[model samples]
Target chain A: MTDPDRVNALDERAAQWALRVDAATLNPQDQAELDAWLAADPRHAGAFARAMAANAYFDRAVALGVDRDIPEVATGIPEVSAEAPRVSERRVMSRRLWLGGAAGAMAASLLVALGLDRLAGSTSLTADKGTVRRTALEDGSAVTLNAGTEVSVAMKPLERRISMLAGEANFDVAKDASRPFIVEAGPVRIRVVGTSFLVHLSELGEVAVIVREGRVEVQAKGTAPALLTAGDRMTVPAQGAITREQLSVGEVDRLGLWQRGEMDLTGLTLGDAARQYARYSDRRIVIDDPQVAGLKVAGVFSTSDPKGFAQAAALAHGLRLTERDDAVVLSRK
Target chain B: MSFSRERAVWLGRNVFPHEAALRQWLSARTASAGLEVDDVVQETYAILASIERVDHIRNARTYMFEVAKSVVLQSLRRARIVTIDVQANAQFLEIPEDAPTPERVAADRQELSQVSAAIAALPDRCREVFTMRKIQGLSQRQVAEALGIAESTVEKHMVKALAILTNAIGRGGNVRNASSSVREQRDDSETSDRSRPRERA
Candidate 1:
């Protein structure tokens, strides 16, 4: 442990040391040892700071699944380009209204905003793609859509509002809990206060609401609003207002597969989850075997390919697959 | 009370609620946060789980604290990588057609990938703090509270991460202006990291 190997690893090690200090208050002698280590090398001091920054990254990434993004071109350490780091910091904190510990993304996003991300305004509904579009309506405060989704905004500064119209989105509605950030999709109207929530909508009219790290308030157009928590989920039928109930923590993760872009299934009917996973992929999974579709299959597969998804599913669930020209056929062996 | 139960109770009194936060902080602080904490905590618990003798008094809190710290220290000696620890194989194949290609683009890509893997393999705590400040955008105080350490600790972690990152950058030659090339590849690599489904996408 003393060799401390490479400098960056050493810094990372130092941060882990600090995490030890924080995980439980360290006794005096150990504390002194840490102090002595810090005092030994100027490089060590530098590594310690990097270690903190790294921990911050891990914390934020874990909280928000802030997938590690490597920009095509070097953008020189993602930092908010806004003139005032102060404003960006406040905006970043407020936006925590989105990612659970998703704050890391906020910083990257602000860099996008100040660097290239465009902001929005006035519309009660807004959908921003690959951008953190922030808007300050005369009456309501609003942020736009996530990575790939699209949305519209509307507002007269009196009745602030927006709609998910399409794709997954998170909202950090301004503090007028009375005038909530409501998304009117099909027949369901999702309302929320000074809180964070994730909404997934598609052309099929399917709407899903997931809460990662905080509380959320949900209500279909004709129904009353319900308060949900970290693992809570609400699904509205594509056509009907009839909403489903709460799901387990494991269930949210299953559904979250698309977001993570990695999924695996096994020993179950392809008819069950394969059809569900097709949502995230470019190609489609057609269940040719009506009965075999119900047959138990298993493996680990990337959600990106229904055809290839068989690998992961096969590995995990023991389902065999036969891929041929024209289409990938899955039959329970 | 049984030794293990007593230890749990003591941890309950000391850790709990913030236990997740502290662990989260520790995970953030340390590289391999997920694996390291689980391993050490498990070992500590296993040892406690097997013990027939319980330290009667003096607040099992100190014992638990000491053990966890010792675990962290012992953990410091363990090997790093949690994910598929492959060195960066960042080929230019997936780079969008519109991406910039300097004469040395491929060479630059190789260097950057090395730097990134080096960053990922950093120790738990330093990686945690480095991630927080560089990526998560938390202030020193927030990181301090969340990780359960001080602002000074957070600063120390950052300094360490930078030194390592800079040194790694230096190792690949031309460390001084390496980020210039880093700046060029900055905009589009987001989708390139882990889950690139060339298998489909």
Candidate 2:
């Protein structure tokens, strides 16, 4: 076995090389030396690859706005009360984190037998902009609600019924073959015995479903049910045949990133991405030109900061951003 | 000999075994040119392998980079896209007979998830500092200012974060057989600290 110190030294060197490569003002001489160091050994090359990959990972995560989720204090330091208002803010944040888990165990006790004895009472959940919530169900399963989404769950002895009133939600159904879990979203109805899947219901009746694990069967009125396994993404337009496509692991991973307040726009039009941002921010993003709306964009962005998104769009596409009191407008420079 | 075998032999014997550095070089250039790095690498490999007199090459590594640069230029010219510098073409002697090949684009997709996971595993303060500097693309001073910490503290956090990440990722894979060789650096002063599970914000 190789010495651990030697490995740490290699990793340290590799990390330095990665940082240098990404440095804003890297000279050619530095590049030449980095290349030389890499060429020196296969091990060096491997370590450097890991380092670079880590860098790219952070690049993507930053774009996705994943970094904004962390609290200011994080874990390394003591929770100091130097700032008066921020101390209160931290308390609220910590309280939110504490309460952030399942709306609570009290949810089960809130069940009244007013409904049919065979049927468990229903619970409705709604998540506003920038608020993602995970709530446990009576049957040991759980549902994670995305921002701007509303879901109502009613479990009967024979069937588990979930109605997506608006927006999107992911369901992790407990295994109960006797009681099939059914999610009704607009024109589509998804049935599963036990599986985790996401259902996105648009106001226009367009529905999209992505299965994380196990199998789910999706159906429309009078149409044959389509079987979607893990990593399957099926999009049903307001009025058209349902389209099914296989999603790469990266693509599927993106689907659940919203739990961390990440907005994954792997392939979205500027208009669509703006709408996604609107779901999180009170300040709306408005594209002044039709051409700007059609511009394709892909990256992760913070949902809570529409101005940041506008600024990024402006910098990236050479567009002009005019921030109004109510909205931020994007147009050609 | 097959082109791949010959090229592999040449790479093993001649070039500085630094695949990571080569890829890094290609990635930076390609990102600016709005081209995929893998495609450029593939093109460069084809040109280098097809050379009739590989034995006559002096600096194999520099020659490969030069050929790679030429491939990008040739591609830009053929496509009628002048995104790169105009003086670039004057620097190359021969443009290989190659067309842009249709290939899958998500070659390094796994790396994103791996890195994200590793970031999630980092200590809270370190993760925050590192994410601000790397992900947010903030300068060290900017990160220090934003967090109300000293610049030196930010740098220390960055170093700690980088060391942790490289150790984790390097051991996991991509630095082949690095698992047996690597160990997580212990910060004796910080080991007493308790880490909270990642909170969903």
Candidate 3:
């Protein structure tokens, strides 16, 4: 190879090593290989160090909110709600048409009225990372928010509306046909006369609405609305198709298990199950290999125990779970 | 206690002890990479503090370093490293320690605007793919399905977007002060890549 070509190859190898080491703790074999590569030449260490430092540049940007792409409206807060129409025209226009028009007016008034409620004068309730909160509204309805969940509630004599900005929540609505309980999350909204249901706004913008009792109508922009009754579930993928399915007895029992800090995965893919675990904990389960993510997993696991989940997933799928750095990485056995 | 408060307390008891070592370790690598030590430290703290169950951390010292190392590496892989000079653009990376003072908040607003401008400057396809991935939190498969493109193409666009932003931020907004050496090398490498014939995936 030419001198420059050789240098380029070395740099690429060093960058790969930097990525590998950062991905997870290397086993003895891998560690020895990395050590050998670093020891082979003085320039190798320099290249790896430089690459690591370069990586740090991106870290600083994220730390400073430079790479944050989600607009304020997507988060379901008031500051961006007023100006959201102009900015969200391209992406959220369809959902906004439903959320910001007449329905939007109802939501606005509901929030204002709820804001005036005697309890703490706060209309918003948020569950922090690794925490679940159960709150009772003034109107006798109860709502349970999972970890890392946020919802803004508004209530009026005519209607009760709750906007879930992120994460998951379970609602036990007070039967009042005069005041339909509407839960808006991302692109999907669930309107119920008075039913118990779970709304999970996934990180990928998908909305999963699981009904425990009664009936609720699930609506998404540009798609036909779906009517779900007791023991029914529907997942609306972002800007795509809506899938309706039945909730098995096991699934029904597992509904809102997060309230008890338990993760009941009934035939969920490893990746989705890991995401569910991540919702309840700060530690992330990184499927180092994509193939491993597709492995089917089912069990009742602890929400606070991602490591345990990883171990169980690994054991079940004939994979390996390596506890490394901040993330537990799962890989092929 | 609130989760954030409880987290803060847990982090104080477990992760805070290693702050000096982590700071020193990260600071030594920042100059060449064009990062502020404080920013790196803050990012490290944020990662550790966000962990849902601190009790699972068998060794706080090792976990803290692991979090810091992974944060740096993850940031790099997610960020695009172009030939921009970011050292002098200190205002963009300097965040107030923990609490944001009024002045610091104002500065952050300015920095956010600049970052938005940078995002706006991304190539059309790259920006779209990036928005879908980062903002909308769509998977590559989902992005491909939505855009009517191949998943590989989406990944490529994301890599390109990160490259553009990372390089731009690395330069820290001062176009003139940006280091030319890295840019020259990148230009050379890109030229070579383009000149080479396409290979099948």
Best by TM-score: 2
Q: Is the docking of candidate 3 incorrect, acceptable, medium or high quality?
A: incorrect
Off by over 4 Å in 3: A1-122, A222-226, A265-276, A284-297, A310-333, B1-201
Candidate 3, residues B1-201, lDDT tens digits: the string is 012334544453444434444554665454444333433444455334323455544445555554454344323212223122442232322322222112232135655565566666665676677677666667778989987878767765665554445334433442222224334434443444354323221
Worst 10 residues of 3 chain B by lDDT: B92-101
**In lDDT terms, how accurate is model 3?**
0.55
Candidate 2 clashes between residue pairs 3 or more apart in a chain or in different chains: A39-B16, A63-A300, A64-A300
Chain A alone, model 1, TM-score? 0.49
lDDT of 3 by residue, A224-275 (tens): 7789997788988886668889976346546655654566565789899888
Error of 1 at A298 (Å): 7.1
Q: lDDT at B7 for candidate 2?
A: 45
Better-scoring candidate (lDDT), 2 or 3: 2
* Ten-residue region with minimum lDDT total, candidate 1 chain B: B87-96
Between the candidate structures 1 and 2, which one is better when assessed by TM-score? 2
* Chain A TM-score relative to the true structure, per candidate: 0.49, 0.58, 0.52
Ten-residue segment with the worst summed lDDT in candidate 3 chain A? A92-101
Quote the positional error of residue A220 for candidate 2 in Å. 2.8
lDDT of 1 at A9: 36
**CA shift of A144, model 3, Å:** 1.6
